[model samples]
Target: MRVRQAKRDQLVAEGVTPYPVTVPTTHSLAQVRADWGHLAAGAESGAEVAVAGRVIFVRNTGKLCFATLQAGDGTQLQVMLSAAVVGADDLGRWKSLVDLGDHVFVRGEVIASRRGELSVMADSWRMASKALRPLPVLHKELSEEQRVRRRYVDLIVRPEARQMVRDRAAVTRAIREVMHARGYLEVETPTLQTVHGGANARPFITHLNAFDLPVTLRIALELHLKRAVVGGIDRVYEIGRIFRNEGIDSSHSPEFTMLEAYEAYGDQESMAELTRELVLAAADALGSRQVAHEQETIDLDAPWSWLPFYDGLSVALGENVSTSTGSDRLRELGKEHGLDLDDDFGPQKMAMELFEALVEPGLIQPTFVCDYPAIAQPLARPHRSSPGLIEAWDLIIGGTERATAFSELIDPQIQRQRLVEQSAAAAAGDEEAMAIDEDFLQALEQGAPPMGGLGLGIDRVMMLLTGAGIRETILFPFVRPQV
Candidate 1:
């Protein structure tokens, strides 16, 4: 650090700007390579162009110097500074002042070196930006802790890190394209709300000073987006951040991106088709519908399988199970299957725990587990045929719940009753229960069309596409403070 600072001081003393306000550039490193890379060895294009990038590699011989410049997208171009072209004095200054991490601007004729490496033969160069600290050792792997703490450095040093950002954007754009193509209106919803009655997740609470009322960072976009449907926007969707006061793990983050779309006059089956299309579209954006994850290849183009929640549980348990199964019997079955069932767990909760442990892991292919217990999803309509089940499905891929859809419950009276039950649970010390939101209820009362809503975890989708963990999908995921 001191050595770099001394070099910066030396440049200032030499009447050179170490941190110039601006520099002219005619092409990105990518464009330069795309246009001039085909030149034969020892051939010069005579196309003088300006380019700027961070210096990643440098070597100086007495009369000639070579420095590799890397652009933000990880494109590299070699800059050859010959004493004849740049003059001996400037060439010498470049060797002395340029560092691996410093940004430099160069004006040069595009050419291929004697060894056939495409390069820029410099006529002039200047410092664009100086770095006070050295970069990490090149080609050395960074520890997970260091990578997460210094993501800027990670993005610079790791090609995969830069690609992850591009892939995420591609996935998001693909989702929006699918939504817009289906005539869904993309919209934004309030991040802070008086009541967070959407998903079954605890919210991060905060105080609103002006209104002098407690508020929470929204845990889901389901409620407000549904309100839009009630307001006559037949189809609406939101790709936004959701905050949950929850535990962190390989697949869970306290804050993450979610895509919630509600289509009026659509049933759970309609949303399932949309969910399939979205997944395939995202996979297509990443250049393949087949993804490699955890030693398995997931074929998004293959026909997806469907299983009722109880039937899946029954298969996993090697016995028939349904809503009629008693809590005590379910607990016995759970214990036999190696689950430590909580005493307070009801029949539905116990069945779910057993299913998650035994069934979810083997659902490597795209499978829609349908007809969950009615209490499991308060916002879903009752199953047309099954008395105790809801018209909902959880899309499980790569052994994780990637998305969920519901035949939305629009009957105001039934919706209120469900929220009332959820409110009681919240009051009874269930932190992950939804609270009653009067405004949402009023919107339902104003008459909403029969709708099907789906919420997809953007991060989890990235994880599947990139074979990365939840934190790696996020640019700057939350990390614990250093002690």
Candidate 2:
């Protein structure tokens, strides 16, 4: 509403359009911040700067007024104006036309305020964009629920929220840099596929008008990244999005970012080592290897502990928790744990429930739970020494499953059989069962190299780095649709 009025007033009085189609920028917030002290120390001669940002706060002292502006790159600058330079009429005009949340370009010189605050003394300013609605004033009183409900407002009021997101961006950049340095080529893959074959999760379905068929959003990037390995990319990675139609919780999002990487001739051990290194690198980028989250400190330095899956489960449960036990015994154990295990929740599923419900939550330290049950790892190669186990590992940190990796199953026949089993499960009413992908099996037949594959939750990593709760880390976590 204010934007329309501003445009009309600009045209009527100044003969200028409020919204100019184009504007060129010479410098960023980072550059100016870097040279801030030098600029402040310099003589107040003819230093002119063109800066654009949203007006965050305002203060008026009769003749002189100050407003805080925030640029896109997470930098804040205080803008000052004096009636001696701006003229009484122009100052009144600014006060009438400008509002909080308005984007404006200012021509200014750097100076220090009476309180020794660095400020940009403005000679002139013009509107870049005008906001229609008033931003919610969250600083005064806001609940956690309200903050989540109005995240954009929360971002405006909470400087910590902005800082945490910036930290997340820094972590992502560090991940890319480390991967590039390690010779991994980043690639993109299809998000909507005919078959969601990678992970055990229900997928969101959508229709493709162009293809004239229904397609499911990908649940994981594992299958396609491995296909890139088959296409002869020695080391490949994808930082992408995945959709899972499931319950909302402290740890899960319906649509989330995933980081999946595959390296040829690498095993679960190699992937576990890389996971530790990458996580540590991210922590270092955040300025410390020590991060405290949820009442505990996590040291991401080096040499994370590795425990065999059965052993870790046993340690957590105070008893031997092995899937190698007979099917009947596994069912009995599941029943003891109050898990309704029938022929439908097969021996493998029963064992998995016992481990997940009774064991996973106890792995608070950074530990790799290695060697999963064969039935638990559909895409992992079988362990050579343990016939019933697969060479897969899950990295557990702060009692959360942060990442999972494995030596990939490259045998086409074995891959096909496992997929068939999943298909049967789906037919038998397991909605989260992986779909059989014939094309993926064909690609496997064409020969994918023995490779280590990893799928890491980037948001979970951010949660660890920022010491933020789950919803706090995400910009707009999914909520129930309003009636």
The most accurate candidate by TM-score is 1
Candidate 1 accuracy as TM-score: 0.98
Query: Model 1 residue 108 lDDT?
Result: 91
Computed on alpha carbons, the lDDT of every model, listed in order, comes to 0.93, 0.80
TM-score of each: 0.98, 0.89
**TM-score computed on alpha carbons, candidate 2:** 0.89
The global Cα lDDT (0 to 1) of model 2 is 0.80
RMSD of 2: 3.1
Who wins the lDDT comparison?
1
For residues 76-192, write the lDDT of model 1, one tens digit per residue: 999999999999999988988888899999999999999999999999999999999789998789998898999999998899899999999999999999999999999999999
